[model samples]
Target: MASGQWRALAEQFQLICPSGGAPGVGSPGALPGLASCGHWVNVAGLQGWVQALLDQGIPSFRCPRCPESPWLWQELCKLGLFTDEARARLEAQILVQEGATGSYRQCPRCQRLVQRLEPGPLRTPCLPCSQQARRLYCFCWGCGRDWPDTSPHADPRCPLQAALHDAPKIQAPPSSLHGCPSLRACPRCYALLSHTLQGYPSVICPECHCVFCYRCLGLSGGHRLPCQIADRQLVCGREAVTLLPMGAQ
Candidate 1:
């Protein structure tokens, strides 16, 4: 459904949660709740709208009634619209679309989405896991193995450095992102992202709303010229000089 239509409906009617409770409450009967825009929205309808956006290849998720108000993943979780399973499914679909399954990983313990913000040691802490376990819990970001208790900084056995240095290159020859690292972190927020290689080398981070060139890792406004394709290689005004390393950034 179009966003405008959804917005109209949301503004006119009180939204009922399909799960039958106010947001963050465990009540069993349907209860109305306000969206971030202060408009009432049906939880089920809003979920469907988000799905439609993803299906249409639109990555950003914002309130239909208020486009300027973006929905963070955490907020969606609290609204009970995106359970762990549902969120995982949505993430899988995005990864498939971007051809970047390697760019993201799930926390080994809680299966929460996890990504390295900067080139760093293989051992990474999962906040959800730590919260649940009531202690610091870490796992290898590169190999997806549980972090050994013997070390605090680095994984003794994982070949994380080699994995980062030998990261895969974009394989889409017809696109301008070809030959660039398949994995990238948002230049502004350091959120993990991957390019589909179907359009311009630029992308908007769903997390921070930062528009940047995926190929050069530069803000869109900072680019002096558009990225180009030369000899089946991506040529940007500024080229990425290094891949993410295993050491801390």
Candidate 2:
């Protein structure tokens, strides 16, 4: 292709990848994983195009993939997108029995179709409201229902996972002296949050609701009281005793 033609082709192929994480086609600068398969075809060739992409673990996607056709699932299945492991799980659990209409696999308990099935038997967890809070264990990726995660599992998102990746590892700017006794600086936002009493259990960030333990100065909640963070975990932690009004105390 000519130099001008190459630029035009690049522009034409610069399709944005959805947040669903199909791969970023928004820019040519993106890495191979982020870039499209470079097949560059319309809906007619979507099936073949995606297959070629997934063969290399590169997700293929395009804009306006709506009016979901019935054949979409069948085509995806034919491509072996649903792995064998998933099928094995679905074997014993009946997904949707024959002659059942107006609903997908009825929840064994609630009989609701709000839950979506994916990759054969790798079905999502049950809805929390549909069942009780205590009985439910695993989370359903379909309805997005679950209890506050204590330990780690294949919950898609790490509940134990902190946005520590998003923000600075240790960012504790010293608070100006002579602030309210109830006030403490938020490491995440750098704003001051007010607690009811000195050395309170947790200081709830009014802006972000990001709970931080006043004692240990680590991200915490009512679930984990008295944060045992003896050693300073902040990235570049500095201890600055905040000044409080003497008359108030």
Candidate 3:
């Protein structure tokens, strides 16, 4: 990326550390090539990181190979820091270390070796951590919101409903569910789950994981529905039932 573009991104994302801080400008022990501006970053495995960033909707960011430490990238790749190669290393290390401490080995994801605190063993990736760092690097473009997740309307500012309003829906093949009817969002509330209300106009949900047609949800409705995980469905002498198509039986 161009130096100007990098500066714009830094300004936009707040990536630069404050002066005199660890990554601050002109620090002697700072990463090579960053001594002058302090924004010099030695992101060795930055290509993969940048790809992940792009998948999350960050535009026009590039990870440049540090001419000096191109070998560092190769070293990280060989060590399998971001791949499953490190899993065996992590497992063996944990087995040796935790046994001495009188603890069983654990992998949080697999739970085979549960004592290792390393990121490779713990299944969850630290995307939220990276997003938090990105915020520190760049200025807020739109109103700040949580990073995107699996929700249909994941983009906080430009929701899926707004983006899909004008798109055409196609009919499905003969072997299909619901004949591929074009979905319509709630005109009032803007949700993907605006199906017709059949049984109860209001269902009292205890765990409150219910998503309903606008008519069946919200504060004025004065109703709550249990999440799928709730042990019991009934609350206050009423029970909430999920309504799916007859074929969904």
What global local distance difference test value does model 3 have? 0.30
Top candidate, metric TM-score: 1
TM-score of each model, in listed order: 0.42, 0.20, 0.17
lDDT tens string, model 1, 149-200? 6466443324433243326677877767877776666665555667777766
Q: Write the per-residue lDDT of candidate 2 for residues 1-249, one digit (tens) a residue.
A: 243533333235432233425334423344323222232223323334434333433321222222121222222333323444543333213232221111233343433323222223223344433246554434332222343343443443321111211111222324321122233456566455444443445567888877766545566533343234322122221233232222222
Per model, state how many residue pairs clash.
1, 2, 20
lDDT tens digits by residue: candidate 3, 38-61: 334433323344334334443223
Which candidate should be chosen as best, given lDDT against the real structure? Answer: 1
Q: How close is candidate 1 to the true structure, as a TM-score?
A: 0.42
Pick out the ten consecutive residues of candidate 2 with the lowest summed lDDT.
Answer: 159-168
The C-alpha RMSD of each candidate to the native structure, in angstroms, is 12.7, 17.7, 19.7
Residue pairs with colliding backbones in model 1 are 120-246
How displaced is residue 123 in candidate 1, in Å?
7.1
Off by over 4 Å in 1: 1-42, 65-70, 81-88, 99-104, 114-128, 135-151, 155-249
Local distance difference test, each candidate: 0.55, 0.34, 0.30
How many residue pairs in model 1 have overlapping backbones? 1
Superposed by TM-score, candidate 1 places the C-alpha of residue 198 at a distance from the truth, in angstroms, of 19
